[model samples]
Target: MSIHLFNKRTALMLTLAATLTACGSDNDDNMTEPPPPQPEPMEYSYDITVVNLTHEQPLSPITAVLHADGKMWDIGMSSSIALEKLAEGGDNTDFISQESVIANASAQGPLMPGLSETLTITTTDELATHLTMVSMLVNTNDAFSGLTNLELSTLDVDATMSWHLAVYDAGTEANTEAMGTIPGPADGGTGYSMIRDDVDRVSMHSGVVSQDDGLMSSVLTQAHRFDNPSIKLTITRTK
Candidate 1:
């Protein structure tokens, strides 16, 4: 009877030990930790600065866009209605809202003659590889200046690229420069007339023939006339 009692106690001790070991193994599995967190994707950014190089023509609110494809304006092609709206009235709302635009920005107000404006644009999207900028010459009829479809992919971060921009005629309106046709403070005239009365094509602008030069009907004087390279643009990749 004593030996049987001793054997029963031994069996109970072994079973308890096995059960405790199994429970410990299960607890270790449950206590395992998760992996570490991941870092966020890097953002691509740029700083764009525009300096009005003209003597008198105040630049309209500048419109800057980062896009993948398509152009804001072409030398030979007819200007889009959106472009016309901008070149004619200094309104950039439709130009920057186009479908091809990935990211866009605009200056708060007109950049005065000999003044400068800076704008920053950023995106995580790798597809936004092209840049375009447009702004009208408020003192001229349908005259605009800026870059179009400029490639940004090759530009390295922290590097800068700059160019002197020439004026371009939207050709959507005649360069009459009449009393009520010019917009700026010079005339306080009508901004946009959708008559399509010009050459109907885009071309490099012929410097204004202000009244000081001839064009007796022109509301502008010699101070309002500008030559090639009307604006200076500098672009820097920040990230």
Candidate 2:
């Protein structure tokens, strides 16, 4: 072969190789990476309503809680200090701050007789599958009413459940209905006391013995008395 021909052929081959390499580089530069995957957010919500059915007994501020499967209180069991505080004094700060609580809501103030209040609670926790509600019968000593450990996992969106709650004695204080021991507007007396002077265990409350009922020392009258199913509670799933 002649030198000139061979040199020409070699130049053409080198040019083809360079063109191919350039095309490949251009393809790489024009390519784009896919966007990062996004995560889905989760939320759950509920609304709780409490109605006072008493004639004159004012209901204390209501505490509504959502938590995992567990009972806050049981009959025949001693009351926790948190429950004691709420039952005796209408203080729910400790009950709402419990470690097991996933979310909580409270009423602004005491609920007057024949009145109702609604509270809403929301949470992102998937483990929260139970509900509890509590409030005191402010006219009596250590008297409270509510439901506990109510299963919520089966509750559907926009669905509701209702109950007529009965009163329970915290067994932390005596129901003297005396001049200085009752906490309601009927007496404006002290609320909670650490002293466990009563049975020291939770049980169904025996209705109050008011001054009209022959208890002379009692500060409460027939007007301050209440019976079972003192409050009507309703729960709805909003989300």
Candidate 3:
């Protein structure tokens, strides 16, 4: 009888131990927590259209940028090498790579007179609240047209703004319009020279005086001449 009672007590103890072990296992299984939340996404986008209004000059491929806050070209300030490059050769390589440029886009090829090109620039950074657009009148010497540091923060999605951009002299070259001096089809001449030959300050371009207009050495004709408001620029926020 004592043996029987000992067997029953041992069975009960074994069952209790097994139950506690199973409970501990269940507790461990329940301790797993859920994953943390993810951050929200952000995006901003803009569509820019530039129309070449010149009678004959084909604009260099357009360069448009969305930045935080800074002027690429300010009147009375000397032109950056990048600006000079673009103004002279229509090469935007250095201009688009500016440190202040948050996002940028460019036209595929020359923007011919009476033609328009539209490009879209997008960024995940909402801080890019300034827009700049630049292009060279390929038929002249250091003549460029564009808008700079125009405020974009208040522009709502789908909203639009427009500007008739005036031409500006890059001030890095002379406007002699001489043979082998212009970079366009008229001469296909040298584009940029490091020497600061002209008035070394940014200023409104006193329109190009072609060969027909009395600049005797000019390779260009009256058809290449241009005045203020050379480009019709329109900007629309897309996102």
Candidate 4:
């Protein structure tokens, strides 16, 4: 081939290679790594502490729940089977599993008098703005202590709230304090009975009427008696 023809062909080949390289560079520059994966939703967490304040009454395993705006129980209303179970028997399985609950944490065991326990619950549900806690005074027939439908939306992270809880009666059973009716160690007897013998509604507890109080049929004694504000509860938002 002639030198002039060969040189012109070489220059054309180099120009084409340069153009392809430039196009590749432009494509790379226009390309973007997919946006950093969006972060997961933030988690909200809370810690609950419960202290048993009675002299002889043992608080049942606590059922701490975070729920929507509804309550688990209302005074003057009929007690739910779940509440009845917790109050009369110190069993919280049904109470924590209620439909309104968004998140829940249960104490590992009963809180004895003068003792305390702490449980932690976490959730991402923004609708879980209310808190409910329930535990029984096991020495009585149907006595319980708790606070229900407490608003927690305004409780900031690291903030704390507390309450001295009063006792309530499930009223599902008569306060007989009989040999086979008291559920605690004082009797080790029956816990729950489907029979609604007493007032079926909830109300403030009138405290236990022990044998020392002249109830001759009662198994409970002076030590088994209790007063209002039988429990102290504190809640802290961790996140």
Alpha-carbon local distance difference test for all models: 0.90, 0.91, 0.91, 0.90
lDDT for model 2: 0.91
Q: 1-239 in candidate 1: lDDT tens per residue?
A: 99999999999999987887688778796643435577787788889999999999999998899998777778888999899989988989888898898999888999998899899988888789899988999999899999998898889999999999999999999999999987888899988888899888999998799998889999999999899898899999999
**Residue-level error in angstroms, candidate 3, position 105:** 0.2
Model 3 lDDT on a 0 to 1 scale: 0.91
Task: Write the residue-wise lDDT of candidate 2 on 65-172 in tens digits.
Answer: 999998999999999999999999899999999899989999989999989999998998888889999999999998999999999987899999899999999999
Give the Cα error of residue 13 in candidate 1, in Å: 36
Q: Deviation in angstroms for 84 in model 1? A: 0.6
lDDT of 2 at 150: 94
The C-alpha TM-scores of every prediction are 0.83, 0.84, 0.84, 0.84
Cα TM-score of candidate 2: 0.84
Q: Model 3: per-residue lDDT, tens digit, 38-61?
A: 777668888999999999889999
RMSD of 2: 11.0
Total clashing residue pairs per candidate?
0, 0, 0, 0
Ten contiguous residues with the weakest lDDT in model 3: 29-38
Superposition TM-score, candidate 1 onto the true structure = 0.83
